[model samples]
Target: MLNKFTTKIVSLSTLNNYSFIIPTYQRPYVWGEEQIKKLLDDVLLSFTTNKESIYYISTFLTKEVGDKAELIDGQQRFTTLWLIALVLSEMTSNNSEISTFLKKGDELRLSFEIRDEIKNYLKALLKKESTSKFLNEHFIKKHPYLENIAEALSTIKGYFLQLSEDYNLNEFGNYIYTNVKLVKNTTPTNTDLNKLFTTINSAGIQLEQTDIIKARLLNLIKDEKIKFSRIWESCENMNNYFERNVRQAFPNWKSFNFKKPFDFNDNLFQHNEDVIVTNPKDIFSIDDLLEHDYETVNINTDIKSNQTEEINENEVYCRSIINFSQLLLHTYRIHLFKEGKTDFPEEFHSKNCIAIFNEMIKRNNTEEIKRFFKLLWKVRFVFDIYIIKWVTNIENKTEQLELMNINSNTDGYYSRTKYEPSSNLMLQSMLYFTGDYLRQYWLTPYLNYLLQDFDNVAPTNNSHLEYLEKMDNIISTRGGKSEKELSFEYLKTNEFTQQRLDIEYFNMHLGTGFKHYWFQKLEYILWKNWKDREEKNFKNYRITSRNSVEHIYPQNPENRIQHPEIENKHLHCFGNLVLLSVAQNSEYSNKSVSVKKSMFGEKKHTYDTLKSFYIFQSNQWTPKEIEEHKSEMINLLKMHYEKTFF
Candidate 1:
């Protein structure tokens, strides 16, 4: 009678009406990078390769109550799957249909019975906050178990962050809800579950894998199960902190992928000796975490007033999006001498990167564990400083900000202008080189000397000048050319700029979609060089703009050319693509040259006047003009920057 239980191969959608309660007596959610990656890869592969096929995601043992199920044996798997659903919900939070499916009364309500804090955390997550952000602000500072959950969640979030580039969230969510099945075994309500669950595992003492890990970690940090657990769990989600903070630190970071926890996390704390010192009040204290409730914790404004340093809302939002694996490869190859001190391979591939980190903890060295967090904070600060550039050094890039400042002079007449950038083109150029997704080969080394106060990438002091120099050397080494160098070479060197162009370099990554940022640059460049200059500089023009690239000539033109011999490849060349506002792009979609030009003047503010002016320079568009304009652009841009293509 104790052995008998019901089983069902139900789709996730079927569980919309049923809530899940992970009993606190169960182990903490310990699915690290290995389990997180596998589940994501399997589910994604299933969704894409065979949409209709049912993927059996192992058995989950639970006991159904009135509207909820008490997870008995398969809590980890169920918790992971529930997290996957949360990821989907997060991505599509704006869609009413999906929002209802994810959060309505009929939809699943996952709560932890043991820790109301953890349950409160989940409830906060559904309210559209970054999981890692919530982790750091609340639980990571205090609760050890939640820290583990946070790391696992971060790894999970990081994987999906990568997949989001190639895979459709809507499709993935649909398949996961409607097709993916799991064998759920509900034990009879009368069974002695604690003993049964314990017997099912090898530990035999009712100890879980988490408990075993806890026991092992306990040796390193004696008399502090609570403290060590908090530190250890935070490391697991350490990747999240890296991904989120680094993204805001640099541009094009959102599309970056960190497949493993150690990818960025371990590199952030490669060595323990180099601890960055900061005020104790800067970091949230355990008392601060415990004193706050979910709402209070979620309200970042409440915490900032008590802090020694105040970060603005824009900076706070900027720090929330991050990805940083490519940099890890650099550190992996150079700093670690091609391998971790532990046996885990030195290469920066696969989820097993954490193996070396686990080996660090396995040493039972409390200092080593402590060092990891210290280094992590240092790296976090470094990334945080770079994010400040979004608000700080932006004027250097000639970025047109939205804000307007007004003043009254002697006559009491109002005068107005956007605040100006303090720096020049070099700052913007190198910032984009390191920040851009496709143009990542020219990356700088992580120099400790370049580090100043805080965890910021850019120093707070004069060392930042050296960081800028390093950026130039790195970018130049990896084939990125400055506007000045390229412009001079094109004009004086008589650079065969167009012919030497790598056609594939312009090709967008199918997975990462890295080419779109070029339009922003191009838009800035075109506006800067506009023959029809306004009193205000293009860089300082306060106008709302969309960064989406659209083909000036229709990609698939309705008005067929007399010479249809032109290849489709030439259609996407820099000559043909132009930055357009969303509404403007839709209006000009597949329209003929004559028609686009007629309205181009009307909506000129939404487009690059130079590009539009050049387009209207001809009566009709053909492969000949496309080639001519391509060379013209190459020539004009080179002349503009005094640099040229090889």
Candidate 2:
């Protein structure tokens, strides 16, 4: 069986039924901040460097017993990249070349089930059915956050448009279509890309079983022979169990780890005062259960597998996390269902997940699933921490003790639980301990909560109790903030997770720190600000586009740019260039830079303070001047820091 094939980049209209299979058991789509930033940066860079439409195709192999490729990896990268494409489409839809690609891409691609899934997901994300709708839905005309991202992409797209004005994009597209490149593997071979992706992403996080369940659900969604109703019902017990027991009864419980144990304090419930912790049985309507149409969800057993082989452990781990996420979601749904509300869907948003996975399922681009895994891993522990705190708080409660004394040693609170490592390797043990304690901290209490609803009976059906001893062993080694700090450290070292974080924290916040870098890189403002080349005059005005932090003050003169411009003597002083936008700074042109500061009252001081700080920090400043300005800079920074931190 061949796992690799190479093909040319063809017209969007030509690629038909060449399914992009994301396995049901693949990890959920997630991208770290940095990886996302890099991807966006790459696209932007490409617009500056690569002239023709650059197409890249990545491929992966599954060890699972199927040909259907569930998005085991690369979901976030795909989604974000697609988003960039969408933005490009919107920007150039008016221009013939870009419009041709955008409209054609939409028309040709979105008709595919996978593409529709992505479109619907994007709509949900944008909170609008269409791009035009997004433009109108908000009072600001264009949502600033989204608009910033779009503009970055739009600028790059425009750069390309101008570059290709003479060359026909359609002609280039035709040439590329005729000569596609694939991974070029004939027999099944594990691509190093997938392996590297798995290693980089698998550090602190492991995919969950719930991810697998969602994959199964998606498979069911695509199956025609099996009624969706039957599939729904088959999953009802599982769904209802999660919802009633987890999402609603324990609103904070989202992930499953067996080490960090949980304990339920039922006595905390006060008939006259406190919130009632209801049972799963009470929450799920019996009428709905009895009348629930299972006929709609039964997926065909013989449904074609997009996967051609068995999925490896990495793939399994990935799918499991997605399944786990769905489980949390269902649990939340159950919470809502208890209140007689239909707040969310039951199908696990398969279309959206699948679509994202499809766009990102490439050999070199496993960053998406890696992100999902990290979050899945982090969230699991976060929930665990919450449960532990919840249980500890309950045990110490005076009101609860009046009803029952449920300490950590009590039946539901199994303090005597044993521990065993699945692997004896030190690293493995640490991972186990980390995962186990974290799991116990959250899962045990969840079970206890369920048991409390069933007359304080401990969990008999759940696997959690059986593993209590192993959890106990791992918990013995549990340290304080050390464990959490270590987890974060592990995450930081993880390339995929880190990259996804960059996208989340940096690229997404482009108007924040990221745009500053852009301004520096482009140097558009320096040209506009400085007009004269100098040597003889020794002009009191200092002019330099040395890529220094945009300073508010001039170097040579102590008088601020805010002081009235005194002709050539005070030209290009600190006040004029300090608060200028990047473009303005570039435009000042080093010529006569004499400009008076605006009398904006309090705002002026803020600008002055900021400008003063920059000047003080300049490496070129004399030691004496730096010392003089240090306290002022410190004060300004201190004030800002206090407000930000405290």
Candidate 3:
């Protein structure tokens, strides 16, 4: 019969007989703030309304009552309420009422197998640690277990803290009384509850197929009518079959998925219409699972509504890759247990284990699993390179080499050792590589070596000079240029010097560098001055390389026809020594023209300065005028510099 449950404000003492059931698979006690606030709010509201005969309750349907109440459903909510009660008990002056409540809740004891774990949980609650600490300490303390309680505890604690200021004790208690409701006398079987839990909490880490299989088998074996000893013996008998068929078939299964029992649905795995029905030849045993032909079932559920982002192709691929990688744990576990190797660590052999790790490619069939495989493979190859560089004289290309101070030899063979690496080294290498690629984008093999010592990565005052030395050596070997080399070639090169002088010094100082068309004006000015100087019979007229362009004038601009401006006839026009070096012209900077004429009389060349000056004066001064333009002169300089650089 369906039993209707209602809230009642029965004294805490009365609750002793009515135990709260939290199944083994149910999470440890976790009460975060939000849940605590909700409870407090509800209790406060109830007090304001003067509600006396009400109690917040949850209903559960289960197959058994003695021992631990096999949690069918409502584990998260129930465990959270229990924690709140404990906190309330601590707050109240009287201890008897709260003690009674706890006694009743603790009446359903955990099986002997997990008694230590149960004790640990109770101890954590009694202590004044953070809610997360309490739950994680018990549930997630080690490997292969689920911690539903931790989340619950966190939520409940956070909730209470929020309401502490606004609501008084009475009001808070009442709020909880009204809001936190649990149905009474609800009869849901363990299987039913497990199914519901799986369905509701499918988003995080869904139960694996093998977990469901194990659940069914466990449920069958747990039956009182069935002799458990015989079942165990049968399991032993069918060990080979189970391992060969079930274990081998689901090689990638993880125990985390089997935290709870199975929720069987007939429709999910329906019988086929292959009609030769024979009397059961062999009774189903845990061992004989291989011989049995059970149809597999998987449900296709929609993505949760709470998911904010639509999964992209990359995300899908990544998730798949992670899932496949996780399967190695099962394979390793099987090998360890079968070989009786109790000392073997439960961690997966990702480095050496050869599973179906596929590469993630852009083409068809490229998914997360594939990507994970490729990434792992690439990292492995890089690690191999590091090792090769380390053992051999070759320089390592990876960043790790620099850290290790290993010299780089681009061309070197990777040396092989006859001995296999120790387990610790292997594990360390795996972790280092995994973290490096996944976190840092660098897959340096040197990380494997660096991470060997815990203190190396620690933030302490220990000297890291040895490591730094190794790193420098590695950097050198790897062909990374030193700072000294960079300074010489890139910093102090001649090209840089030229660029600096041209832009910083010459361009800003004189307007001469400004215009490209000013060369003609400059030439005209020089020629006219040259002629005046020649007429005065100046000597020592020699061309200079520094300022050499052309000499067309006498000492005065007006000596020929370019310009008539004159102070002394020796006032050289800007065009006079256009082609002479600055050094050569500066030697006669303020000298008179007669001085140069006497010096030049010794050499009677037809194209001497005086003769050349007349020839320039004979030409139309328009050409000279144009040649004297500053823009043309500047252009000529610009062209020369550009050509030199180019």
Candidate 4:
């Protein structure tokens, strides 16, 4: 097994000796700010903890094509690494070590096959002195295919700029070049590359850490291993509802009754009827667990047909905010907190979850392992019912945060209705965008709240919305507070202490430096209090993953003579800025105020930020209007804060 493939661990610095090609069949660069930020942050954490220690990135599978290697997998991470090197070169003077991996002489070390424009873009990026100038010149011209690459570059630049002065970039770059390592697994010459790519994408050939954890837990209870495995498999499919997962995984369990979509009872896991075991052997390995797939059984043919047809017509195209690993951590944290343990971690990091759980199970008895899985089932059920998912429309490809209402028919079959934008959705979207993308701290407290006496809690009551509103207030005004101070226990007993909202303080921050929280929070405020005739404009509005801040009045107006009265002081203040997606921000680049105003009106959907809609609604954008709008927006935030929390 080990003779045919050549495998070796190589550092970023050693990659300077090799060239790679991204085949045309590969997807375009699709890593967004969330992904780029997570990779950089993970590396930075390793660098800070111990610069001398080696940080092992994942493996890369490639085939040797002449002197160049064709990337079969790991293209996204590889492209991101190259972009990091590019950003580091631009920001610092002594970047020879980093630049060597980016290029060899005049030729780039990485190239896209048959993508001439992308190749030219990469070359131009190397020659330009500043990434910002290159992005402005090329991205503003509307290369729709390269938007992800451009957005990634922009995110990398901003991430480095915001680092504290104490952290030396030169040292960090040196660490990245020398200490960060990836395993390179090169395929043999006779291997069929096409079949390899298809197999890698369509199937899971390698065992994950989660699978090992499941194996370890199941090994503890030999008598109930089948039951535990079913629980684990059901919880793993985060995209589907828990009721459906349970039905599919435990098809032979006749006592199970999904009376409602959110009905999760502890007794539901007991084997009231005899369950057919496909593999009855007592000694099963991790590979056996990984290979096992549950056989689907139709409960009611008539209801199942109707459900299938309805789902196919209006498919709920949605993605979970957190993955299965993070879900495990969330469920585990709640478990420990309920047991009156205080040593658990406050933040969720997927890299650390395995080690944390290993330590946890080390101290647990067999009974404890069974209890954990039972709790996981319940937590996942409540999660699907109460949390917001990134739901997209099939026809338009436009996405919004949606809390879907689960509907049940007379035969007790469950289906989901189309989502309508509500306060619960808006509030969660605000938190989702404003907080750390990798670690959702808000979920710990919110999920814990829903799980309390969960069997008795009504999913239709307004209590869920009220609890989220209070949590938002606490999170918003939590200025420099520690996580311990904002724990679930603290949320249960505390009311928000009103803080003075300073208009002048907010006015001082300018440009991209302005906090995005204010802009997003204002959108929620506007939507809640909206009574205007333009109700259609905002009725369907929801917060999205926005990072770029756009200036309503162009900083360098394309037609310079249009709005000269706006002074530098009022130019970049809160009133002039709106949080927008990267594509929308580039599309409105440097246009005159009137041109921007016209573009806003022509669009059928609502503005990304409702504040922008109101700002552009004015007849003119002079200094006087900026000052008045600034004051008015601040007053709205101030009043809303006071009313909601105090």
Candidate 5:
């Protein structure tokens, strides 16, 4: 049956016989960061470790539809492979073979048999047009597959930026074209994919791709096999490697060896309170105004790029090491996502990278391995720098650099706003949402904003605080649906737990980080107005990890005289909550309301927030007061929504 019709191992380069088409049954392009990275890692490993001159990725099951072949089971991999090919084509401009398949647009076609709106949406992306209005106004509601396409596009472009110039990109491109092979499988006459879906679903996965990736990465180190293997295994608890000092050490990426293990005791990296320790020699080379030029001030200042690198001189080397991983999703998000939200798969994001050993015994030439590692490290470095200080890769030709003049001037925090969000406000907002507990409603829009404004060559008209406004509209107008309700509506997850909820209760149901997110956003918005008039210790008031929801009415009533207002009912509700430091919460825990107010005065710096400051106006503690405070806070939230959307 396999031989009767047609089957051939076709390299992506010389392939031109049949056009590939994605059917409507393929649904949304759901290959997320995990799937995307896994595919890239798998292919890279195959190239680096496998000895096969032609590495067959998988078989594409299809039946001919006119001149084009209707893709049945292989749509996801095909889409990803095509995107990777496009990236490589740009990387290797001189190579005609890599670009030919794509330049001849008919070779890879999108035949959305059911969802017609998506055809245009994809065309817009390919044309490099501003898809915001189409995405916002029509496609979102009209096309069900919109989210997947948007995500895939965002993920691909973001990863492409991570490819640094240290690698032989041209050669890698050639490898992708000349070596990445696929088998074309065909059945008889034209048939609806919906009818064939059951048969395709039963077909098993062909390759254990990630396992191969592990063998390849580990194979980098030939010496100190046992020691490094142990370290690699332990590190494989799986996390992205964070080499903070490599920016300084390897000013050039072409030379870093993935195989050579770094000693944890080495003074190269000094992690001080989860921050990368940088020296005078690390960041600056400026010779002008505001101490340093704009170019010298790292794109991402959240790393304390401009601040003094004052850390423990006699610091222990125990907590400073970062183990490298094949799945660099964290760094990938850092590059692409303005507010890196967590939704990536656990194994893809969490596990340690397995290095290629002998079964990994595949044979990639030294130059190929070196080049692959260069791409890997480039992705890591670009993403790390993006998260810390938004710097584009100077070596990456794909990174379109801005023509700028930085001779003497240097005071662009992108800071200093009057009422609206300045460049600093947007930048801060992006830095702000890097927590794991962000809601999907907000994550979707936030990713959209970053891809549009931050990654663009020039900022757009609606690219400022208005972007925040649009995002707020997107999130706040989750149509007052609860997480369960929204999940059911969109994701088709109709569990027994799913129920209806109003906006107020929905607010209560938000994640801890998301609650903190809003409280901090409000704090910053109000702080900008209050920054003037010389407020003591309040000038630098920004959200810290220590700032937590402080229950004014304590969770547990004291052993002493109990108050009716401080009941178990009100303890966990938003009515009793305000932002306070961990130290302050501990200090005021179970204390009388009057005593807590007195402590609040002493620790005024902690209570500098408008939300907390509003609480101080009422001296007494009663159920009525708590209810009123809750009402006021709710109004503030409403006001924030009003300001953002309208």
Candidate 6:
């Protein structure tokens, strides 16, 4: 029966030929704005980055029932794609595209089992009978699952609307319809559907390529394999600090202290020579590790002990921006750059990590492999201290990108001190939100910068901040340079200079089509130079992941007569636009400028960008006010550019 299963790769256009049905046992649609936006952005990026490239979205496991295919997996992604088709159909206003691609005559290509409300809601949206207000009021409240679909629809619509000015909508729509693809795996009819579903749901996570690489590398090192494996495990635990990971990994070792939390030295695992260490029972050799099936192997049994340090419940949870695979790639890039290899790839994708390292291993010696692992340890130490993490606030449960300064007490216990937000955190947060969430290109060069003087002494917070600010300017102004070229330039020279911003060349009226980076960058500049009596209002401000570009003077206001003085041409301009979260954008939807200002005043803390707050400071929004605000903001940006780049 397993041999009878069939699989084929199909483009979105080809996928449209078959109809799909979600089983009654399937989970409800749970993807929110973040997931939906990511899909939209990823597809858009694929189209823009390489239009000819066939982007494989994901694999879908299904079982054929008569003419319809029952989706066993990949429903979330497929549903999102269907919603995208709906959005494109509405934008183009061509029912044929929908009929041919997403629907069979008037019937949707996809349907839910025992879920009529959702099916009806989708039909209403397709027929143009559903409005944003209608979704919020009627269907969403009754059918809770519809909320995600509604939000997804809004997110898709808003994403396209925002990028309309910058991208070719027709071309993008066509690319999504034709270029995007999925792999469909059809199970045999004889297969037990219930058993298959149970197995899939109860399955454990598959072994990562990193795990394979670890095994392969450890097989080569006859001596100190356990110690190196421990080091690799410590670096893999990115959530906790490096020192804490080291302590957890080496539980029996007493008197452990890093020169500093940020600094790494050779004596990290070295303990008192007088202490007798007992090796764990039944240790497996590299050959045994390589030959055994990872699923059946009890790899943790050797390390597991009752004396192991328990995790502290009160400790702040900090999430690393990049995963272990990405960190390994970054560390490997730095290692190659240091070894006088200038052609290493700058872009990072976890899927390609094994291949990237495989090429490296084939060319380098076993000793070099050991060195790479050691460098990974050192890199992670600096990364934890210097990088901005999504630190969770215990009380509010809100996460913010923060770089907490580590303070060591006289007794050698490290505590995270609440340091005031510095330019380092602000600039990193700005770069973080502005760049690709998956491919953080800035870290490669920035991590290399930290590694340059790492052995002598760790850099002070002020100097580190200055270096990052300069890197930010270079990244912002490096108009057409490839990421590899930019990384090489950053590595090869001390003088980091790039193209300067020409204020005249920038379209102040780009509105939704404007690059989000500029808005986020301006926010950083405003926050850095803030000195108003309302300092308390602006002090806690940090740039977050915001996709919606809001207009101060609403494009379609509820009260039409509220802002008649504002001209249509100035409505989408930089002066009127501010980057905001999707929820906030929905909250401020189509309100009058005065009402929006009143809403801003009502909040105790201002979550809006400082630039937006500045605009709201004016009582009435008029063409005169817009022009005045535009001039001031442009000058501010230009001045900062000059100060940083010149």
Each candidate's clash count: 21, 118, 114, 0, 19, 0
In candidate 3, what are the lDDT values of residues 14-51, reduced to their tens digit? 44445544555565444433344444444454454554
Query: Per-residue lDDT tens digits of candidate 4, residues 477-543?
Result: 6666644346544435454553555556677846666667778888888877777735776765667
In model 6, which regions exceed 4 Å deviation?
1-4, 37-49, 92-100, 114-117, 130-133, 136-144, 162-166, 188-198, 219-223, 252-254, 258-307, 345-347, 407-418, 453-460, 505-507, 532-536
Q: Which pairs clash in model 6?
A: none
lDDT of each: 0.47, 0.30, 0.32, 0.71, 0.45, 0.73
For each of the candidates, the C-alpha root-mean-square deviation to the true structure, in angstroms, is 16.7, 22.4, 35.8, 5.6, 25.4, 5.2
Residue pairs of candidate 4 with colliding backbone atoms:
none
Tell me the RMSD of model 5 versus the true structure.
25.4
> Across residues 1-646, which tens digit of lDDT does each residue of candidate 1 receive?
3335677878667776777888867978776654565566556655765778777777787877666788877788777777777766777664412344445473346778878767667666776455545434444547776766765665555556546676777777777777778887777667665655544553212222333443454556654344333333332222333333333232333333332122233323222222221112223322232234322222121111111332333321121122333333322223232124422343222222344345656566676545543444434334333322222234355333211233334422233233343222323432442242221322223322223322332222334543443333323333454332332232222222333334344442232133434444444355545665543333333223333356666766776773253666556566666654433455576777678878766643344434656677788777678767767765554443333223
Residues 566-637, candidate 6: write the lDDT tens digits: 565688778888888766777788889888888888878755778778898897788888888988999988
Q: What TM-score would each prediction reach against the true structure?
A: 0.40, 0.24, 0.26, 0.84, 0.36, 0.86
State which candidate, 3 or 4, has the greater lDDT: 4
Native-to-model Cα distance after best TM-score fit, residue 410 in candidate 3, in Å: 48
lDDT of 2 by residue, 391-492 (tens): 112334411000111123222211111121111111122222223221212232232233224333222323433233233223322344332233222222
Measured by TM-score, the strongest candidate is 6
Worst 10 residues of 4 by lDDT: 297-306
**After best superposition, candidate 5 residue 426: deviation in angstroms?**
9.5
Whole-model lDDT for model 1 versus the true structure?
A: 0.47
Question: How do these models rank on lDDT, best leading?
Answer: 6, 4, 1, 5, 3, 2
Q: How accurate is candidate 2 locally (lDDT)?
A: 0.30
Q: What is the lDDT of residue 508 in candidate 4?
A: 85
State the RMSD for candidate 3: 35.8
Worst 10 residues of 1 by lDDT: 298-307
Model 3 TM-score relative to the real fold: 0.26
